[model samples]
Target: MVLSVHEKVKSERLYKAFDLMAAKDLDAAETELHAGLSDAEAQEDKVLAALFYSSLGVLYKIKKEFPKAWKFYEKAEKLLPEDPALKLISARLLIDVFGQFDTAIRRCQKVLEISRSDPPFLHQANVTMGLALLKKGERTKAVSCLVDAMQDDFEGLLSASNIDLKLVEALLRKRSGLEECRAYLEKALRFAESKQEERHVELFRRLIEAFPTEEATDVKIQM
Candidate 1:
């Protein structure tokens, strides 16, 4: 009975810490989560303990303390190896903060192997992999991965407005001087049905415009 009561208290504290973090009260969140971790340790709750470390990692990442972030993330991963979300997040943080692109790509690949049907995680994994690949000058592989992810159902992504595959393709095209993919820009524009879609489409339009205009508009038109 005492142990259960203690666990409940720790759980509540952990949630409160998470709320504080969401509210951007980093200091308060850290205090509360650390307190929860202390209680969880006393109760020998491995799962809750892992959650605490993962929560701290997120906080540290937000604070731009990458080393501290990964420290806790590693602990959490050791405790919960099956958590694809945590693994994905850790890989992203590593890529973003430490420029460990190769490691990030490898981690994301592992996520892809296990998360074939999980759209959201798969999207994250692919995005991270694409960005990492881009950093390594592997533009073709990057675009292939990113395009596959963008072609997936948007309902699984965080913001339907944010998946700008056309921009990535444009970037790759411009770097490689590949004018053949200009049709993809038009297709992306056609796909833009909503206001958010239109905004992203406009961005892609600008990118395509930046690409050197071959001949003139009259050449393509049959007036």
Candidate 2:
């Protein structure tokens, strides 16, 4: 279906706002989004309003304004509750920023149920769920989810965050499984080498050195 003139204007403004964000001009991006959001609100366009709200949420996240980000994200989700991306970001922000571990886990559970066929979404939901479970003091289950995420979709895990680094750090902090940690870094090292992510390769190398396996072979993943 063809977009009306107002819709086309809104779309153009959205693209322009992102262009500003890509250039790291976050203040300008915020201004652009605010303007677009006013138009969406004036028009009573829930879809466009949700889009603007979500974009504002991301902007605030980049600005490290977690409270404001969550506020906007909630607004977006209220308008489009079934959107998986909104739920995922809500889970992430809850876990990483808001310290609401149980809430994040519940959001991730919904994602897991709804996103079973979407591998990328599933990978991130699993990993994030594992993190939330870990924070909630379920060590055994957390490790199981983390390892499963890595084993099932290493590439997909990488697509979202610094997967290996986060996993290794969590294990190290917990002092849970040195063998598993070492193997994780080893796999990450290989991926970094392949991708030519030199800094990550070096970081993984250093982390692997700390583990120091005597066997000089691949450590078996227990999960």
Candidate 3:
């Protein structure tokens, strides 16, 4: 679809804002987001408005401003009802920031039901659901969801290795799945190596060290 002049400009600003956020320039990012929102509203583009609102929500979430994030997420949802990606992000915010485990689980499940072909979103949904379940003290179900998430490649998302490491750490805390955790750590280590993520590689190495001596020796041999 060919975007109108206004849409093209709005899109550019949104991308700029994302870049600024990644650079840790929150003030500049917020400025660009508000500017994009203005352009979107002037163009009467609900989709663009929803995108800016969602971006704002993400920005505030990263800043640890839960109330502001929630407000923007609500605005985005109101603009674009049943948007799977936005819903997944909102669910994550609810779980991580707001401590709304049950609501996050339901929202994530809804996204999972609708987004069968989208592996990245599916991975996010399952990971969010797992975190929520863990928060709710449903460790068994949480492990199931985390395992399901790890089964997917989750290509194009940089956090895949971190998510895998998180699952391994969660399993380690449970202390009953050392073998399975080792497998996941191995996968995460490979992913980290592929991405040249030295920190994550070291993190996986440390986690592996926590395994039983024999198992750790075996894993080292396998590596």
Report every candidate's CA lDDT. Answer: 0.63, 0.69, 0.70
Tens digits of per-residue lDDT for model 1 on 1-223?
A: 0111122233788768767866888999999988988887898877678768877887898899999989987887788777566466556545554566886788788888888877667766777787778778887887676566655344454443434443244344435324433554454444454435656667657746764444332212110
Models sorted by lDDT, best on top: 3, 2, 1
TM-score of 1: 0.51
Per-residue C-alpha lDDT of model 3 across residues 96-174, encoded as one tens digit per residue: 5457788789888888888777666677678778878877888788778866776744354565333534444555555
Model 2 per-residue lDDT tens digits across residues 122-147:
66677778778878888887777667
Candidate 3 — what's its lDDT? 0.70
Question: Top lDDT: which candidate number?
Answer: 3
TM-score of each: 0.51, 0.56, 0.54
Evaluate model 3: give its TM-score: 0.54
User: In candidate 1, which residue ranges exceed 4 Å CA deviation?
Assistant: 1-74, 152-159, 162-174, 177-188, 194-223
Q: State how far residue 171 of model 1 sits from its true place (Å).
A: 3.6
Write down the RMSD of all candidates, one decimal each: 11.2, 10.2, 9.4
Candidate 2 Cα misplacement greater than 4 A, ranges: 1-78, 117-119, 156-164, 212-223
Error of 2 at 9 (Å): 22
